[model samples]
Target: MMNLDAVEQAGEQIWQTRKKMNYTTLGLTVAYTVQMLRDGEIYIPEYQGHIVWSDKKRMRLIESVLLGLPISEFFAVKIDEEKWELLDGVQRLTTLDAFLNNDIQLKNLERLSKCNGFRFSDFSALEQGKFESRGTRVVLLLENLRLETRLDLFMGINGLDKQATL
Candidate 1:
């Protein structure tokens, strides 16, 4: 059992450590996000999970976008002025990228049934534009942070212990 004073001291220490971490939140448009991915601006860490979302799940995500539902914010760590390491939301980001790049065809979209068989190209120009302009929220842990801390945070955020080497 922990002493009351010791517990309070530990809590204060945790709060102070968290205060030292820097981060920011912003809304990035789909077009900008796709461009970043295409241009290789964001880095996916090796320990990140592989894309395993089923076609139905992917379709539902797209359907949510089309229906204006809020998506969970992506978490990344800034590597420098021009690069970032993605920590979370890889599945969502990649799925959106694949869909916009015409690599994914919508199927089993319950809410957007008419778009079930459609690809990005099949959408009307206005609809396509709207989709491209959609904003996804992202949380970025700023640069200058230690790699170990970043990895620890990633593990904490994802609840994984893959023994990442870097």
Candidate 2:
């Protein structure tokens, strides 16, 4: 069986390319989200789909893109309708999306020796100062995988905190 949890090899290059893309993925996702917003797509806030992300986690994800961090933690799944479903790390994705769209400005870091940030928008070079100076990384997985048992998987992915017995 494949170590679905083991970080994939392409993780590094994808992360590098993403940084080279200078928040390109984030930009695209943001634009898509914006269209959703304009289309009046509403996500229930009570779902806490509105969970607030902190500066530290945002920095880690930004750094994950900039530094070629491995794709160790989560699985990326392409849902039937083609939505990019993060099997885990919803909070992380939300944070990255928010920062990229300027719903929040990423905080603290210095310029990347590799790419010029200004040619872009929210990640304009000005924001590069906030990128994690080191230990940044992320890798994209190409596997079209769904858990053998989605209920167990969803509970596993979301955690057991909500399950309780009276």
Candidate 2: 10-residue stretch with minimal lDDT = 21-30
lDDT of 2 by residue, 61-150 (tens): 565665545423433443334443444455654654455555654445444534323222545464444332222122223343444332
- Clash statistics: count for each candidate: 0, 10
- Tens-place lDDT per residue, model 1, 10-112, is 9999999989878999899977887787788887777675537888778888998888787888898888899888888888888999999999988878867
Every model's TM-score: 0.90, 0.40
Model 1 error, position 117 (Å): 0.8
Q: Give the TM-score of candidate 1.
A: 0.90
The residue pairs in collision within model 1 are none
Candidate 1 least-lDDT 10 residues: 157-166
